[model samples]
Target: MKASVKKGLGTTIWLLSMIIILGGALAFALNPSPAKSIFGYRMYEVLSGSMTPALRTGELALVQITPPQDIAVGDIVTYAVSPDGTTVVTHRVVDKTTDSEGQTVFSTKGDAADTVDTNVPAAAVIGVVRGHIPIIGYIIGFVRANFIASLMLIIAAILVVLAVKNLSAGKKKKPANPS
Candidate 1:
């Protein structure tokens, strides 16, 4: 490839990478709740082995908001475990039914669990799991727990890359001395 083409390609890649990193950092910083959704999707870090063999611990689960009436048995879902909606759990819906007041209730169980969990109300449902990425949850959890350190590390990495690039450019621009 020509030098100009190579340079342009490199610039484009660098710019794209910066946008991704900075955008992620900004999102993380501005997140108001643990269950906040982006573009109608929410991400949850699988924290236990309950859903193992399907959704493993350390994997990142992508969940999409779904109406209670739309949920069916056998669909994996993430729901609030506490009344305050502070704690969340992801499991497969083993049964679905309506309660005395005609409210939708779902009984969930882990893939590896021996028994099903208590019935969860439709109001507590966060979303249905759409997909997952292995090990990304661990990285995201670490960064979120250490936001300041992660941000500093990212900034430092960017600086080092820029410095190295400038140094190399400077060397390439130096005129060759005639022997």
Candidate 2:
């Protein structure tokens, strides 16, 4: 009978994976977006006139759509439209009325818009503008668009795959084949 034990790079990779997963989970819960240096969702450069004075064209807006329950009044939110349409509407909540069915409906309108928007179902909200870096979001967006982190991801994938293959191969081989 042959017995195999984890060793060398395999042990290192396993330890690294455990550390990373646990570390990421801890950081995600304790550390904020800034502390972790990770944005929860895609951000875009405002290219529309709707946001106007508040968020001029070319200004960066970090967008992340969450469930209706997360939507709050006065939150700058973006919503998606049906059929390949999307609106980067940044507006304050004017009013909220709950339906008899236990659903909360919020009305929001952009600062520059003429009237309150179509009743924004609490379901349609993205997220609050927690913080901003003025023009800095654009730089981050450009880097992501170009896949600047591609190399890091590729290396991580290779390491994981090699570790898995080596670990499995170690288990299958007979002791007589040791070399």
Candidate 3:
């Protein structure tokens, strides 16, 4: 291959490598699973504007699973809202009190709401918000919703890379004479 072509291909490969490395690192850092909490914080994607001002919809929130006794009235917590534990919500703890059975119950509310939500048992609480990243949650949600399309795009990218490699390899193999 000509020097100019080699230089162009080298630059393209370097750019692609950098993009892949950085994107993977960013995704891993912002969306860590329970088993991958290197920073001791769990990441959640905010799905509603209930916690607006402090945490907006489409944002990424980092939370830590502190003990129930450690939680204070003003803390923002992620908790399951349904009996089946499928529906989750994030709200500020308005009150903390023990029930008749001496079990701790939390009265939570959205920052934008005028009233507290239904009391949430301590066992239903997932974690307390430590911090948040603006707008990263939208990308994560989109990828999850359109997983098939994303997979197709990834496959297309791999095919393109393989085709380029084959073309370059073929260029390096030429007959001794054209005849």
Task: Please list the C-alpha lDDT of all candidates, in the order they appear.
Answer: 0.87, 0.60, 0.81
Question: Quick one: best TM-score, which candidate?
Answer: 1
Q: What is candidate 3's lDDT per residue for 1-179, written digit by digit as tens?
A: 99769966986797688669756755675442433453667677799888889999999888887789999999999887777655678899999999999999999999988888989999998789999999888877776678667657766876787689768867887567767
Residue-wise C-alpha lDDT for candidate 1, range 1-179, written one tens digit per residue: 99767876897799688969787755853575866777988888898999989999999999999999889999999999877776899999999999999999999999999999999999999889999999988877888789889789878988888788868977997899999
Model 1 residue 120 CA deviation (Å) reads 0.7
Which ranges in model 3 have alpha carbons more than 4 Å from their true place? Answer: 1-39, 152-179
Model 2 sits at a Cα RMSD from the real structure of 11.9
Query: In model 1, which residue pairs have backbone atoms overlapping below 3 Å?
Result: none
TM-score, ranked from best to worst = 1, 3, 2
Off by over 4 Å in 2: 1-39, 64-67, 83-87, 133-179
For candidate 2, the per-residue lDDT at 170 reads 70
Which segments of model 1 are wrong by more than 4 Å?
1-26, 29-35, 171-179
Clashing pairs in 3: none
Q: On TM-score, who's better, 2 or 3?
A: 3
Q: What is the TM-score of each candidate against the true structure?
A: 0.80, 0.47, 0.66
Residue-level lDDT of model 2, residues 34-91, one tens digit each, is 2122455545456565766767655667655456677667777765444333444566
